[model samples]
Target chain A: MAFDAFQKRKERQLLWLLLPALVPLLILTIYPALYAVYLSMTNEALTGVAAAKPRFVGAANYLRLFSDGRFWNSLFVTFVFVVGSAIIGQFVLGFISAMALRRKIVGAPVFGAAILLPNAAPEVVAGFMWISMLAGGDHATLSKILVFFGLPYVDWLQTFPLFMVVMVNTWRGIGTAMILLTAGLAAVPAEVYEAARMDGANPRQMFMRITLPLMAPTIFLYMLISTVSTISVFGLVYALTRGGPGNKTEVISVYIYNQSFAAFQIGYGAAGAVVALVVSLALGIAYVRSLKVEV
Target chain B: MAGISEKRSGAYTLLAYVTLIVISIFCVLPFVWMALASIDSNVQLFLKWPDSVTFDHYTKVFAEENGVRWFANSLFTVLSATFIVMVVAGLGGYALSRSKAWWKQPFLYAILLIRVLPSTALLVPLYKILLTANNGIGTVLRPLVGEHYRFVMQLFGFIDGYLGLIIVLATGQLPLALWIMKVFFDGVPKDYEEAAILDGATLVQRIRRVLIPLALPGLAAAGLFAFMSAWGDFLLPLILLSSPELQTLPIGLFRAFLRVNEIDYGLLAALATIYLIPAVIAFSFARRFLVQTFSGGVKG
Candidate 1:
């Protein structure tokens, strides 16, 4: 009975400890999220009559959003961005880098440092840095290099907005992918590799049969993180293209921002944001389910 | 047979080295070019190699543009947010780690779920809340403070101030910080605290003397991450703090790009370089701890 009373007291203390974190989270995260749902059903705006007196439209914004071609375009762009940058580019290059770093090569630290350095720059800073390199003109770094090679200088960003954005995001994200995959690589036991070698398994076969299967959970976790975060990437893409050159690079986040802040349609933007939320929640559930299966 | 295998292994090693070098160059080339552009004059930017380097662009960042103010604003907001996250996450993490409550598992999962939710989804509603608070607080304070109404209103204002941004950032980072700290706290043995309790050490005393010192590295790692996220953030500050005087580094750099007529490549490059310095320095200092945090997170 005395021990039970002590346990109850301890539970109360734990609740008290949680208050500091929970209060801010409730206000900042939970409240905003619930409010977003409410806002999505109204005809709110930052200006005009809608700003002065927003009325409940009851899914009108969502209905309009479903019909909007630009909304569809943003979703398509987001799909390509997530796949090109996070799934394919970062994973492939990052896995290779992780595998390379695992080897006892000369200058391995220097190579690791170089790969890690790009992540140090903030998104907008990295975006501007790339703008200098891939900016549309004869004077840009890529153009200058092409000119030196006796080739015509091409405006990279203008000619290929989505591709350039994807490439830049991949560059910024490879370090994170490499770090996570390296941890995964380390967890695979050396004795397993030795056994495979003794069984006359070639390197490629060993990797396919052993390392890839072992690293599946970690890879899924990385994908879950990178995909969700990449979907919300705003500053980098915005700073680079501003969803311009005819909205060719308007990912969902940018589309929402343009609608809310640029077009001043808060309700419409909230509806778009709701769609983004649902997509992310769906992706999160899928990844979590895969993780459970892997475990 | 051994000789043939050795020759093939040598070729494989050569291939690995070549690949590593090429990837490293691909990663580093943009920063090198940006640095070069920062030091070059407009005319020199077009040249293959500049004849001379100049600090003209660097000077212009401070002289014409208010770079110092933006840097200070960023420093203040990030540091304040980091401090809040450390305090809140530290307490909560200790509870989650040490407690045996049945609710802890579900609560922890909820926190993780909150972390995965895209922050952009909350932007519109957050904007509305801030706007409401701005008007509501003004009306509430007008009668209470009377003569000192503006000062009091600004203090409570959420729309365009440091307080709102700090709160939002701290909340956004709390989950990761809490998780990292919890992992560290779990690593610490219970024997020390048990012994302390036997000697009649108070809860605060046990925490301060025993738990904190052991978890210092974890705390530092979490604090560094929180600081970086806050410092590097563009969206929250962009929408929340609308005043020119309140601009952070990312916002400042963006404005410079937008506002400048000729798109002064040299000046923009210099500003970006300046913005990159603190993050690089922080990463270099905390690289080991940060990596350990990631590994710990993944293993769990």
Candidate 2:
């Protein structure tokens, strides 16, 4: 365990280097996390001073969250949104694109970059685009198209705001997922595919038994990140529906914002915020464990 | 391989190309619509497209409104924040890479905790901290630095201004930037640095002359990521900035689009399109870097 002077000096230098980064990390991040935990336990309201005489309400917030119908509904909406967008919509579309491109199809690089355009587009803009398309032309693009195809011109936001939001989120998210998956697809050794093909494994069979198994870690990581991202689906929903013609599209993040900023229920809002953090933390831990197993 | 596959793979290649083209068009259709609608006149916007287009909205946005000022404010704020974050994360990442330090694991976990913590949770406490600044230690510091500093550099000054947005956005972006830089730095073999050190190079010299040039791509990727995160940001600006002139593109676009009473899809599309240009350009340039970052980080 006799370390050289160089090693000791290196360690000292490293510590010195990390200190500047650590300050903001501590102030902006660590302090906020601790403060949130502190805020969650209080009976403080949004309008007033955080109480000098506040009573501690030990898990009262958590208890209330379970009973709240809105919380449960929002949670369901969040899951569906993530699954629809991140998992099925983006993830699958992304995988297929990656797979096709991996076959060394002509213009793959151009398509690969093109696929990322949606993810790169500003969310606010995405909302507008979807709204315009779904809203249909006044003379009626959807209606005309639907009629031509023997379908109905459904009012997307009114009857199907949740579905609309999920589709929009998926549209935006597919690019990122596709890009990550393409990278994952690129990393798979070509010889493995060749060997499988030589063994008379059909493309579908190879995908299921070999490609899928090898790509599990990437899939899991994408799932976790996508889930975390989708849970906070605020901007798209906000821009599209404003939590709706009813409360149909009101996910947790928007609800929290309304409660805190608009409704001015500071303590209750903090409680909602804490719940989101806890749920995400649980997911994060599960993801980290899975990552550990993969490694 | 190409000649052998020319006929058989030709059909499959055609199918793939067709599918990819369709998807790409669908992906870019929003932007196409946005550009079309932005220049569309008010009647054309609300009613339908005519044989021609107009630039009335863009003109209005540029001249008769606070849109230009807001855009400038956003650029200034986000750029400043991005610059600050790059410097901090670069230094921090270098340290983390080079050292087998005592607090390294804890430091990394701390950064992760920050990364995972939702922005909503921090709003209340941050608000309180800003609200209380000038009354206490702030007063003491204010007099020492003269009243000008208080007006210009105080936390309260930052609380609702571009400065505050810069700090919060920079803070939010710091952990990721640091992590990316750390990974990038880690990938750079230590042998190069070891040779430099043995040749009597100082720490700064080794960093400036050896490490930086090698890590330019990583730095570009990190910088672009930071810029996008700050630029397309909504929550931080929404929570912190109350001034209309202080709004960023995301917030501004959201505001314009969410004018529920009016419900102008054409104007909304136009505004959204305008808002999206920077991101589209930035991502187009940095797409490869972005893909690499995600894959490398997630792969590990």
Candidate 3:
């Protein structure tokens, strides 16, 4: 009877210990998530200082988003951005770098560390730096260098906004992918590579037959994560162009921010946020499921 | 046969060097240009590098009276926030790993949701909350923070200082830190904990001895991540700190870049490069640990 009473008291104490941790999560994370969903359905001007109150509007905000031209453009740009940077940039660059540097190339480790520098830097700083570099004017050295080499100074932001964002983001993101790929590559035991080499397999054959297969799970993980990261590419866009050269580089997050803060169209912005949520949810679920299947 | 193999290997090695060298150049070009631009005067930025060499911008960035304050604010916020996260995440993760408490899975999933949720969704609400707090109940939390010995408000010798910034960043980063530490702790088998328990060891002893020491590499990696994210974050500091004196490097760099009437590209680049240094050094040192952190997250 005494032991049962002691166990009950212990359980109560554990619950008390948990409440403090749980309360913060409830306040910050959970409440915000539910409130975001709620805001998505309301016709509110969310400019924080506005006198307007949020009113019920059902799915009108969402419906309007579907018909918006800029919304569609932003969505398309997001797809392009993710594919161009995360899928092709990180995946391809990372895999190739890992394969090429798999053996002892002189200064390989140093090279590996150097490649990660872009990602290590503050992203806003990177965005500003890239803008200064590519924004060819009297001071744009890259353009000048290209001109010296007899190549045309392409308008990176004006004529090629999405492309510029892609390159910059890709440059910034390659570090994470490279590091992940390196880990994945290191995990594949040397015996497999040695055995393949003993059978007169070339480097290409070894990478294709043994290395690629072993690295599939890692690649999938990297792809999903990189995709998510790419989708959330806002700081670069926000800093560099402010989604401009005429909204050419406006991504979903930027659009959402502008709507909510700049235009005071909180409801419209919340709807955009919902769309982002849905897209991310779909991608995240798919990634989680893929990871599970591989496991 | 040995000669043929040797030749082939040599050829392969040469090809690898070529590929790696190209990639490394591509990777470092933007950074190199950024560093160069910081030193170049406005006129020389358009000119060739041989003609464009000056430290005028670096001097400008440092000479700005507010620059020191901004750096101190950023360093203080990032360090304190990171410290809070390490403490909370370390303890919470251990509990999550060891105890199948009533709300464990639900709590974990909620954190996961927050971790994946777009920052856009939270920004407005968080802003409103901060505004409300600033206006309404700021006094209420002040005394509590005082009692807990944060004493940050008094120590910094500035009003509306690092304490507020630390709390927000720490809270924002909590989920990921907790998630990482949970994964790290989970990787340690239950038998070790059971053995400690069997040996009449207290819960703290088990955590201090078995769990923390085993998870050091993962903890280092996670701590590094928190540090980098906190240091580099732009939006939070931009929105939260209205005072010019409390701006972080990213925010300071951004404001410098965005100034109207004669944009200081040289100064902007210099500041950006300055802001980039810590992240570069920290991540490069912890590169291997970062790789493992990713793989471990994937596995989890």
| Top candidate when judged by DockQ against the true structure | 1
TM-score of the second chain, cand. 2: 0.80
TM-score for candidate 3, please give it.
Answer: 0.87
**Model 2 chain B poorest 10 in a row by lDDT:** B42-51
Ranking by lDDT: 1, 3, 2
Q: Estimate, for each residue in A1-295, the C-alpha lDDT of model 2 and write its tens digit.
A: 3558768877888777777778777777677667777877777665556555566777787688679888777777777777888778888777777767766676677787677778877656677677776764333344455667877667667777888788788778777887788777777899998999788776678889988999888888888877876776676777777776667787888777777778776667778888888887777666655655211
Candidate DockQ values, in order, are 0.57, 0.52, 0.50
TM-scores for every predicted model: 0.95, 0.89, 0.87
lDDT of 1 by residue, A71-183 (tens): 99999999999999999988898899999888779989899889888878888988888887887599787788899899998888989899999999989878878888888
Off-target runs (Cα >4 Å) in candidate 1 are: A289-295, B42-48, B143-156, B290-300
The prediction achieving the highest TM-score against the true structure is 1
TM-score of chain A considered alone, across all candidate predictions: 0.95, 0.87, 0.90
C-alpha positional error of residue A280 in candidate 2 after TM-score superposition, expressed in Å: 1.3
Q: Candidate 2's C-alpha lDDT?
A: 0.72
Taking chain A of model 2 alone, its TM-score versus the true chain A equals: 0.87
Docking class of 3: medium
